[model samples]
Target: MESQLQQLVRHTRVHEIVGDVIRVHATGVALGDLAEVQNTDDEISLARVIALDRNLASLQVFAGGKGLSTDATVRFLGRPLDVVYSPNILGRIFRGSGEPMDGGPDLSTEPRVKVGGPTVNPVMRVMPTKMIETGIPMIDLFNCLVESQKIPIFSIAGEPHSELLARIGFQANADVLVFGGLGLIFDDYYFFRTAFEEHGVFARTVMFVNQASDPLVERLLVPDMALAVAEKFAVEENKRVLVLLTDMTAYADAMKEIGVAQERIPAVRGYMGDLYTQLAQRYEKACDFKGAGSVTILTVTTMPGDDVTHPVPDNTGYITEGQFYLHGGIIDPFGSLSRLKQHVIGKATREDHSQIMNAMVRLYSEAVEAQRKQAMAFELSPFDQKLLRFGTLFRERFMDIRISMPVTEALDLCWKTLAECFEPQELLMKQALVEKYFPKDVGPVAVNEAPIHG
Candidate 1:
């Protein structure tokens, strides 16, 4: 005869079966009163038992769902969800359930572990000082990416956030790249896979992808799997891992769906009340583990209608250190920033880096105002006239996303452009830097340099 605990779990119907409400009796607690849910399509990792009665047990499912049946069996496992972890997870992919989707091998045979664990205490945290060079001029020269840093690419659905993530994965100085895709289109998945393969970094990269076609619950697991694998690599293999997650909005939406399933009171915007805490837990995973390689998180948050005030972005903005805003094709310098850049800019990079970045953006902002004035047909002042020419050159030369140059070369180009367009005094850079960096003026020639005005 089976034990009473086993028997209790066996008879109880999975709350998710009829809806998302489990039933357990007081005696069931001794037999691990919780019921194991049988989710045929989506992965439902047990989170918590929020509300429980003598006959009813309400559980929170990590991966939210829409198609669960209340009649499904909820057998008590007497345990929480666990995910397997190890340095071996590198170059691997997983579903939101932390199950392998890479067509390689099943991790079921290996010991499984849990994701969304508690973060490290602040007392153990060390100040971050290492720089991660992506070779992207906008990122490297201005807002330098740092180890253990958390940054988000804030964009709308149509923007090229995935492209940017792939670019960083391929080029970032980190030893390993773990990519988590949630609610991604098939094309985006293919694009990331192709980009890494073409760059020959696919072997060093792990992709945990939850496509738009996958179960919404699965989409929720992508980040946890990616982070778990990254944590293993960081602690055991001593690898500097960069974890990239996309479209956190989908993850939040999944939460809302699951909350509805469990009949929990909705918080702001129908999101779970724990939204901020949930985000902080994941983002706080970025850490420079003592005596080990660091883990950095650079995820994408797509703002619906480009509204930063949207809950997803709004919460993310508070949690992440900084954001890289992508609009049109270029990373908008005005909109993007790395708060940790202060740790690297000028201090770790070239001395001219900080000044050049500041000068360039200041000029760009002035150009925007000038363009607005131009649009309004305002009479241009001498400085505004000069700004007009500078703005045109800035877009064609610097702001174009296709413009890829080494950090040093980009700084030199800035000096050269200024020399060509304006006298040294107009540049407003330090007098000493002007003398050292400013390219030599093309001196007047007798007749060759002069245009013959007839």
Candidate 2:
């Protein structure tokens, strides 16, 4: 019976154009089948019927239209946007849309999997305690990277965030590095690739990058694609995976695009209301699979206008364990924190690790105050003089992100630097620690005078 009315097949897959993206579900179609998409607003594009669907068909429309008439054809794509996946892709780079950008040959039907899917089960979770050291004192010495910990480097434009990520990729003691670069300019992408190749770590790393010129929607798929590959490696190959996702703000902006497309109601700062849930779904992927390897996510979330309360960073702060704040060409000691460091610092490191770390920071903080006093032309006490010295050396030696050293060497260097600046009593450290770490005065002050220059 050919009736004028065609019922949307019951139990057929449906997708809601909510949240700027319409995700397909088996029964989601039934919910909006009666719904019609019409070009009510001049801004919305009128969707053309592509196919009639019970199972999957194909649907491509001109312009993203809000008032989609139910009478409009909704031919399905038979599947979600499938992404190619294979172990042979371990050391490759790809565009945001999952196309190889590394000038490699086509994957040639190795098999493709969809990105941006649901997370693994929580019951399969394992507590985090393992440490992935980058050999950079600012990170390894202070904010220790724990296995399966999800963290962010909060920064703005022009920070060495990209270089820092590259350093970690090369130095971190992890089996795999899966980097998802979202919305990077050409030079930025070029830097990462060159850095990895120069260090000869390209064989162990993989990148999924979305550049500034690519379609905006493609940016949304990068992190998910990178993570998807990471998850597979961990569960199947038991590889210790370190996933680095840069410029999360780009991902957030993409979310906003799809949200507006679905005509979804906006939440704080014009982002979709489900911001937290979306971030959590991605970050919660950091975990140690039982009897297998782990996944640790370290991401870049650039603060727009340097405002921490900018909706993107504000929400990310809640999701990640803590942040490494990059400012003023340095990883700010005060702003950077590792909430999970408590679990691994003393346990995974040396016995005096906690004490030395705390004491060093306390001394550095005092040094800052001394420097400020010096700037005000205040008379410098002997202690102030010592602190001022310590602060100068601290910034040059430890605080500089470019300074890389083993954790033990860093501690030893700390002791040496302190001893050179002040007497043992002035340090006020535990006598036992002094006795062990303090260098003995072997000789009097050296006289290397090239005839005193006035």
Per-residue lDDT over 416-449 for candidate 2, one digit per residue giving the tens place of the 0 to 100 score: 7778677888777888888887888632222221
Clashes of 1: 25
TM-score of 1: 0.85
Scored by CA lDDT, what does every candidate get? 0.74, 0.74
Which parts of model 2 are misplaced by more than 4 Å?
A: 1-75, 441-454
What would the TM-scores of all predictions be?
Answer: 0.85, 0.82
* lDDT, model 1: 0.74
